[model samples]
Target chain A: DQQVKQNSPSLSVQEGRISILNCDYTNSMFDYFLWYKKYPAEGPTFLISISSIKDKNEDGRFTVFLNKSAKHLSLHIVPSQPGDSAVYFCAAPLDTGANSKLTFGKGITLSVRP
Target chain B: DAMVIQNPRYQVTQFGKPVTLSCSQTLNHNVMYWYQQKSSQAPKLLFHYYDKDFNNEADTPDNFQSRRPNTSFCFLDIRSPGLGDAAMYLCATSGTGDYGYTFGSGTRLTVV
Candidate 1:
């Protein structure tokens, strides 16, 4: 089973609409979570992050909400733009000490139709 | 921009051929990692180096090996290429203390 799961493979929304992407985790020990955006021919970039202590973090048009009890999290992009069309990945850090590697979910592709 | 560079982004090899993908980072991070991404799947961590110490994934094949000769350069070596090994290989680096990684444009390996 995937430790982190992105159930939706593809999501399409019109420009200026809210795009919500969801993720679930099976591991309760995950203390940190992150979201990354990737474009074709380019590597994934760090977008935002949240700690288990807080439920929400907002960075401009993007906000990440975490629900520890449900073992779920979501990335919300407000007024989605055509430029926002890309693959999004959710990641959790394994407790592998100081140089821990991140475990990622199969990415979700967002299509913001203009 | 602290960029991560991958040489020979596109590579083609015979089934039994050996191939090496390279990555270099300007970030000067002490931790560097190699990941393999297949079609319709997330990037999987193959192994990593914390300075000179090598850490490998348990599921990674014996044919797959990695080397970090120095802090700036890392190489992923495939001793005998197999059809299943054809995929995008990514290199990433992060601060040993920060753990926030920066990734490079991947090397797409095609086994014919």
Candidate 2:
């Protein structure tokens, strides 16, 4: 069974518009969430993350919102640029202790058309 | 500068041959992880090392094994690879206090 789910396989947006990618998790024990971005032939880079204690965290033009009650989280990128086209993955640690290791969701491919 | 480095970038091995992939981290993070990713799929954790303690995922195949000789180096050894083992292998590291992980450019393995 998948612990994290990115039901949407892909998302397309026009340049300078807002792009929203959604993710859901079945495990309630997850208290920390992270988002990663990847380009072709490259490793996934850390984007942004939110502790369950906070409902949202923003970094530059990227914002991540978490809804613990709903077991869902969303990433929002405003003024999306062509360079933003890549795969986005949502992840959470299996536990919040010292041995925390992440469990990733199937990535969502984002295409920003200019 | 890359904090994590994976060697060979690409590797091709014949069926039943043993292969070893290496990863080194400059960050000196306390934790190291090995993850396997098939095409268009999520990265699945195979194992990890917390300092000298090695932890393996329950579902990881016996064909796969890992060794962490020290704080900065980790190795993945495939005893006998099969065609189905072809995939991108990723290495990552994180400090205990940090929630975000730094990943190395994966090594793509092609088993023939």
Candidate 3:
């Protein structure tokens, strides 16, 4: 069973515009959510994260909004740049233990057109 | 620069042959994890080591085994590789309480 799901396989947006990627989860025990950006042949780099207690978190051009009641989260990039193109993964922990194991979505490929 | 390092960016092994993938971390993190990622698929957890204790995923195949000799090094041993085992292997590290993990570039394994 896929606990975390990224419904959209890919997204395209014009440069200087906004790009939004959505993710959903069925597990209610997950208290933290994180987004990672990956480029071709490279490892994933941590982007932004949000706790269940907070509805939103932002880092520079990246912002993550979480809705605990709906078990959904979205990542928004404003004024998207061509360099922002990459695969984005949404992940959540299976449990809240000291050694938490993360479960990731299939990932969404984001393309920022110049 | 402290980082997670995975050796042999690429490897080719004959079917039914044994192969070992190595990982090391200079980050001095307490936790290390191994993940297997097939093409166009999400990374799957194989196992992890918290300090000296090793933990394996229930679904991980018995053909796969891991060893952490110390805090700085870990190894994944495939006793008998199959064609379906071809994939990218990732190593990650994190501090005790930190939820954020740093991952290596990953090693691509090909079973011919």
Native-referenced TM-scores of chain A, all candidate models: 0.96, 0.97, 0.97
Give the CAPRI class of candidate 2.
medium
The clash count for each model shown is 0, 0, 0
Q: List the residue pairs that clash in candidate 2.
A: none
Off by over 4 Å in 1: A96-98
Sort every candidate by DockQ, greatest first.
1, 2, 3
For residues B1-112, what per-residue lDDT tens digits would candidate 3 score against the true structure?
9999898899999999999999999989989999999877888999999888989999999999999998899999999999999999989988878887899988999999
Q: How close is candidate 3 to the true structure, as a TM-score?
A: 0.97
> In model 1, how large is the Cα lDDT of residue A1?
57
Candidate whose lDDT is highest: 2
What 10-residue stretch in candidate 2 chain A is worst by lDDT?
A93-102
DockQ per model, Cα: 0.74, 0.69, 0.65
DockQ of candidate 3 is 0.65
lDDT score at residue A25, model 1, on the 0-100 scale: 98
Residue A102 Cα positional deviation in candidate 2, in Å, after optimal superposition: 0.3
For model 2, the stretches where C-alpha displacement exceeds 4 angstroms are none
